[model samples]
Target chain A: MNISLILQMAADADPERIGLVCDGERWSYRAIQRAAHGAAANIADIGCSHIALLDESSEAAPIALFGAALAGIPYVPLNYRLADTDLAALLQRIAPAYIVGDVERAKRLAPEGGHTFCSRKDFVAAAEAAADTASGEEREGEGIAAQIFTSGTTAAPKAALLRHSNLLGYILGTVEFCSATEDDAQLVCVPPYHIAGISALLSSFYALRRIVLLPAFDPDDWLQLASAERVTNAFVVPTMLARIIERIDEGVQADLSALRAIAYGGGRMPPELIDRALDLFPETNFTNAYGLTETSSTIALLGPEEHRSAHNSSDPAVRARLGSVGRPLPTVELEIRDEEGKSLPAGECGEVYVRGEQVSGEYRGKSALDAEGWFPTRDAGWLDSEGYLFLAGRADDVIVRGGENISPGEIEEVLMSHPAIAEAVAVGVPSTEWGEAVAIAIVIRPGCDRPDDTTLRTLIKDRLRSSRVPERIAVLDEMPYNEMGKLLRRQVRAHFQDN
Target chain B: MKPGTKLKSAVCDTEVMVIRGSDVEVMCGGALMSEDTPAEKSAIDTAFAEGTLIGKRYVDSDGSVELLCVKPGKGSLSIGGASLQLKEAKPLPSSD
Candidate 1:
C-alpha cells in the first residue's frame, strides 16, 4: 500500500526506461529508485515523523516523495508561494520535521521544535551515501504518504492527510499499469503542493511515461518545452490554458503535433475558452477533470469523446454538456444531498457528497466523513437527469435574497454570455432588506466600452428569474484569482465593499 | 504465495506482488522467490530466460494466480514450474 511501491513497480518492470526529465537531464527508473533508496535512508536517519518540501518543482520532489514513503513518514509539500511569515508559521505547526528545499527558510523556523534542514543537493548527496547501508524494508500500510495543506480558497488552510492506501487505491482503480506507450512524454506544469502534481507523478510512473517537468508555468515556456520534449500528454489549470490560447492567438507558432491529450481542472473553466482551445488543438483530446484534494485529484472527468460530442451537438441540452463535469469515475460513488442530508433527485441543487477508496476525508486531527462514509465536499452543485455534474459556486458563496437561495454561478454564467464581459464573479454582499443580495465584480473585454449595470442586470433577468439579477455591478480591469485559478470571491467582495 | 505477498526475485532485481492467492511456486530466473533480498544470481533456465518488463502483470494459464511485476529483471516469471505469460494491458482513458 506504500506509494513508493508504485515507483518500485515501475523500476522493476523497466529499469532502463526513462522516468523523469528535469533541467535538461534524463532520469531512468533505476536511477530514481536508487536515489529514493538513498533519500529514504537519510530520512530514516533524521527520525522525523514528517518530511516537508518547501521548494518549487524539481528532481527533489519525487526523490523526497518516494524517499519519505520508504522511511514510513508522511511527505509534506508546502506552498512555496506563501509569504515568509505565513510559511514560517506553517513550518512551526509541522515542526519536529525533516525540512527539505530552501535551507535558509528552514533555518528561520522556531528553533525549539527540533526541526532539521537540508538543501535538496545535500539531501540527495546524503541519500546517495546511505544507499548501500539503508534497508529497503517494508513497513505497515497505515503510514501517511503525504500531507498537503488545502489551498484555502475560502477559509484558513488545513493540513489534509493522504494515507498510503488512499493513494494506492486511486492508482489501482483509475490507471492501468504500463498502459502508456514508451514514446509518451507528459509535461507537468502544476506545482508540487497541488494534488494533480502528485497524482501526475505516481500515475505517470506506473504507466512508465517519461515526465517532463516545468519549474514554473509561463505559456510560452510551456509551449517551447512541449515542442522540445515532444510531449505527448500534459495537464494544466484553467488559467494556464487561457493564457496559452491567448499566446496562440497572438501568433506564437510552435509545432505541437506530438501532444495527444490535455487535461485541465482546479477551477471553473469558461466555456468560450474551451471552445477556442478545442478549435485550436483539433487533433488533441481534452478532458475536464473534477475533484478536490480530499478526493485524491479526480473523482469525475469529462472525457475527450464527451467534449467532442458536446461541442458538435446542436441540441441545447447536449451542447450544454460542455459546462458539466461529466460523470463520476467508475471507482467513485456520488450523491447530491440537501442540508438535511437527504439524497436529492436529479436537477436538484444541493451539496456534493462522495464516497470512494481514494477519498481521504480526514484532516490532521479531524475526520469529516459521516457515519455512512459520505464526505460532504461543501461545494454546491447539481446532477442533471443525464448524470452530468454541474458545479455551482462553493456552498458559502450562495446568496440569500429574502430567504431565497440564489446561485452565484448561475448569475456569473449569464453575465459571461454577454459579448462584452470577459470574466465575472457574483458574491453575496450585505443587504439590509434581503439579508444578502447578489453583487458582481466583473472584468470587461479590453477596448470594449463598459456595459451599463442596467444592461448586465437585464441580460441576467432575461435568461433567469428577476430575483437572480445582480443588485450591484462593479466593473474592474481584471478579476482577482489565486495562483491555482480559483476565483478569489472573498477578495472580490472585499474590493467591492471597500470602494 | 498469498494475495498481497511481496516476492523479490532470487536471481535478479525483479519484484512482484501476488494478486491472486495460490500455492504454486513463483520463480524468477529458475530460482525460488522470497520476500527479502534475493539470493545470488542463478543460471537462467533456457526455456524461461526471456526478460521481464516492469508494470506488466504475469499470470498462469488457468488464471488462478497473477503477479504484477513491480520491477523489471533479466528473469521472466513462472508459476508452478510453468512459465507465466505477460498479461495483455487494459488501457483506461487518461483522467489527469
Candidate 2:
C-alpha cells in the first residue's frame, strides 16, 4: 500500500476532522486529501523522477510528501541549512526533479537546470485549486517513498531510501488508527528533513491528531504555541528540551497543563536534564525513542512507566535503566555483535544489529543488510539482563588507547556528572607513546568555575579505569552539535589533533 | 484477488484492500465484492450483518486471505460462507 492510503483512510473516516493547523489556519482531513491529489497531478505533469522540498516546516511539507507518494516518486527533503556547495551537490544527485521551497533559491541552485521549481506559496495554492480526483499512476508498496540523507556527524551524508512498505509497516505496527481524541493536537517543531519529522507527520496523520507546525524552533515561541494550542503531545531533541527547560527556569511560564506527553530522541539526553524535566512537568508522560533514519524511525522506546520507575528507583541497576533506550519493539529483533561478527550475550557492549519489516537499510545504489537481513547499525551498545538497551557513542567514536577499546560515552558520562560541567565529549587523539590517548572537551555550566584538567582526570580515574582518563581537556563555551542535536565528536577530536 | 487491490461492497459502504492474495471469492454483507462503485445499495444480509470496522484487518480461519477494512459499514467480511476473524491488535506504545 502506498503512504497515500494513510491520508485517504483518514479523510474517508472523518472528512471534516481538523487535520492540520499552521499559522492560524486550520485544514480539514478532506481538504488536505484534495490538495494532495492536486499536488500529485502537478507533480505527474512535471514528469519529475523525484520531488524535493528545500524549505522549513510548513503546510507544503505534508502536501509534497503525500503528493510524491501518490505520483509514484520519491520525496527527498534537502537540508536547506547546508552550505551552497553541499546543497548543490545534493540537488545534482536528485536532478531532473520538481523542487518545491523558495522559488528564488531553487532557481539559484539549479544544477544543470533540468529541474522544475515552484514557490511554497504557489505550490500550496495550486494544489488547493486543482481537481480532487486521484491523478497519478498506482504506486507499489515496494516503491521508494522517501530518500532521506543521513545526518553526517562523522562523515559525508548518504541518501537512505525508505520504501513504502517499510514506512507503512512502522506506522501500522506502532500507531492505532484514529485513536486520538478530537481535541488532541500535536506540536511539531523538528525540521522536515529528519526521520523523526517525517514519521511524526505520518503517525500523527494516521492517529487523526491535529498537527500544529512550527516552521522554526524558539524556546519562548514553542512554549507559547504549546500553551495557546493546548498541545497534548510534542516530540523534541535533547538540545531543544534543554533550551525549553532553560526558558522555564527563567520564570517564563505558560499554562502548559494541557501538555500530557513529550517524547525525546535524535540525541542522548543528559540524566540531570531529564530528571529536571520530569520534576518540572510532573503531569506529563515522558518517552525516550531511539532509532536511525534507515530503521524508518523508532525501533525501541523507553515508555512513561519505565521513565518514572527508573527515576525513582533506589537500586543502581534500576536507576541505570534511565540511560537505556528500553527494549526493542516487539516487531523488531535486536542483537549485539562483537567485532568478530559473533552475537554477544547480555551486558556485552558491541555493535547493534537489527532486523524487522520496518528496517530498510538501503542507501542509494546499495543495500547494507546482511544475508540474514540484519542491518549492522554501527552503533555501539549493550542489552542488560532485563533487555534494556544502552547505547555507547558510535563505534567509530570509541577511543582506542594502546590495545584497549574505551567507549567515549563512558568517560563523557563521568565528566558530565560533575557539577561545573554542562556538557562533555571524549575523543581519541594521536599519541606516540600509547598509539592514542583520550582527550576531552567540556562546556562549563553558567557561572560555574572551570575545573582543572587534573581535577577532571581524577574524576574519570575514580569512576573508571585509569586508562580511560583523558590526557588533555579543553573548555569551550559550548559543545558542537549538528542541527538535529547530535554531538559532532569528529570536530571535538580535531581540537586536540594539532596540539 | 491480488494483494493491494481495493474492493467495495455492492450492498453497503464497506470497503477493503486485499492484504493477502487468494482465489476464493470474497463477500461483504453476503454480496460479492467488486472494484466498481455499486449503482445502488442492496438489502443488507441479516446473517452477515455483524459490521466491519475501520482500520481493522480481517483474515480467514487459516490466515490465507487477509483484508484490511479501509471504510467501515454494516457488512462483515467473509470467504466461502465463513466469517473472517478480526486480527488481534498488537499493543505497542506510540514512539513517533
Candidate 3:
C-alpha cells in the first residue's frame, strides 16, 4: 500500500486534529492531506519520475513526501549541506525530477535542466491553491516510497530505495494508529535526508501526533521551542544530545517537563553522556534506537524502562545493558555471523544480519539481501546471553594487528572512561613490527590537564590486555565527526600518516 | 477482496480497509460490505451487534481476511457467519 494511506487514514479519522506545527503555524490533518493531494497533482502534471527536496525541515517535507507517494513516484530528500560539486552530482543522478525547496540552490547546481524547481514558499502556496484538485485514483502495486542517499562516510553515497511495503511494514509493526493524544507534539530536528527523519514523519502522522519542526538544530532554539510548544517527544543524534547536555550545564534552563520521551540514534552514545542526560531528565523516557538507512528506521531499541533499569541496576550484566542497543523488534529476526557466513553464539562478536519485512536492503541498481533474505548490515556487534545486542562500530572499522582482530570500540570505551578524556578514537596505523599497530587520539576535557602517556597506558593495561594499549597517543583539540555524529575513522587514521 | 481496498457497511457507519484479503465474503453487522456508498441504512442483526472498534484489526481464525477499522461503529465484523477475532496488539516501544 502507498504511504499516502497513512495521511488519508489519519485525516479521515479526525480531520480537525492539529497535525503539524512549524515556525508558529499549525496545520490540521485534513489540511496536510489536501496539500499533499495538490502537490501530487502538480507532480503528475509535470510527469516527473522523482520528487526531491533540497532544503531543511519545513511543512513542504511532509507534503512533498506523501505527494510523491500519491503521484506514484519516489521521494528523494538530498542533503543540502553537501559540497556544491557533490550536490550537483546527486542532482544529475535523480534528474527528470520535480525538485522542491531551495529553488536558488537548484538553479545554481542543476542549471535549469531536466528538472522542475519550486521554492519552499511557492510550493506551499501552489499546493494550498490546488487543494481542491483531485489526486486521481490510488496507484496499484507496490512502488518506491523513498530513495534516500546513504551518508557515505566510508564510501561514495548510494541511493537506498525503500519500497512502500517496507515503510508500511515498519510503521504498522511499531506504531499504534491514533495512539497519541492531541497534546502530544514531536520536536523533529534531524535533517529530512536521514532515515530517522523520514520515519519520524511517517510514524508521527500514523500515530496522529502533532509535529513541531526545527529548520536546523540549535540547542538553544531546540530547548526554547520545546518549552513554547510543550513538545513531548523528540529524536536526536548523539552530537545533538551532547550539545544539549552542555547547554544545560551552562545553566540554560527551560520548562522541559513536557518532554515525556526522547529517542537517540544515528551514532554511538557515550556512557558518560547518557549518564548525564539520565540525571538531567530523570522523569523522561529515553530510548536508544539502532538502525541503518537500509532498514526503514529502528530495528532494535533500548527502550525507556530498560534505560532506567540498567542505570539503577547493581548487577554487572544488567548494568552493561546500558551500552547495548536492546533486542530486535518483534517483527525482525537478527543474527551475528562470522566470516564464513556461519551464525555465531551469543557473546561472540561478528557481522550483524537482519531479516524482516521492513528490511529493504535495496539500492538503485542492486539488492544486498542474500538468498535467505538476510541483509548483512556490516555493523560489527554481538548479542549477550539475554539477547541484548551490543555494537562495536562498523565492521570495516575493526583494527587488525598481527592477524588478531581488535574492535576499536573496546579501546575507545576504556579511554573514554578516563576522567581527563572527553572523546577518544582508536585506529590501526601501519607498523613494521606488528604489521598494524593500535594508535589512539584523544580530546582532553575542558579545564582538565592532559594525562601523561604512561598514566593512560597503565589505565588501559589495568582494564584490557597489554596488546590493546596504544603504541602512540595523540592529543587533539577534537576528533573529526560527520554531520550525523558518526566518527570519521578514516580521517582519524589519516592523522597518524600525516605525523 | 484485495489488500488496500476500502469497504463500508451498508447497515452502519463502520468502514474498514483490507490488510489481507481472501475469497471469503466480509460481513459487517450481518450484512455484506461493499466499496460503494450505501443508499440506505438497515437495522443491525442482533446476533452480530457486538460492535467494531476504530483502529482495530479483525482477522479470521486462519489469519487471512484481515481488515483494519478506519471508522468505528455499532457493527460487528464477521466472515462466513463466524465472528472475526480482534487481533491482539503486539506493542513495541516507539523509537522514531
Better structure of 1 and 2 per DockQ = 2
| Model 3 error, position A243 (Å) | 1.8
TM-score of each: 0.89, 0.95, 0.95
lDDT of 2 by residue, A274-331 (tens): 9999898888899999999999999999999999998889999999988899989987
Q: In model 2 chain A, which range of ten residues has the least summed lDDT?
A: A133-142
The clash count for each model shown is 9, 0, 0
Q: What is the interface RMSD of each candidate, in Å?
A: 2.4, 1.4, 1.5
Better of 1 and 3 by lDDT: 3
| Residue ranges of candidate 1 with Cα displaced over 4 Å | B1-90
lDDT of 1 by residue, A1-499 (tens): 5888888878866889999998898999988888899888777767887889988888889999999898888889999898877787778888789988888867875556888888988887787788787787655534789899997775678989898878987887778887777899999999999999999999899888999999899999999999999999999999999898899889998879999999989999889889999998998999999998898889988989999999999999988989999889887999999889999999999999999889999898999999988889999999989899999988888888999988888888888888888988899899988899889888889888888878887888889988887888898888888999988888999986897
RMSD of candidates 1 onward, in order: 3.9, 2.2, 2.1
TM-score evaluated only on chain B, model 2: 0.93
For A89-184, candidate 3 gives per-residue lDDT tens digits of 899998888898888888889985589999999988888888786654556433899999987777789999999889988998899999999999
The candidate, 2 or 3, that scores higher on lDDT is: 3
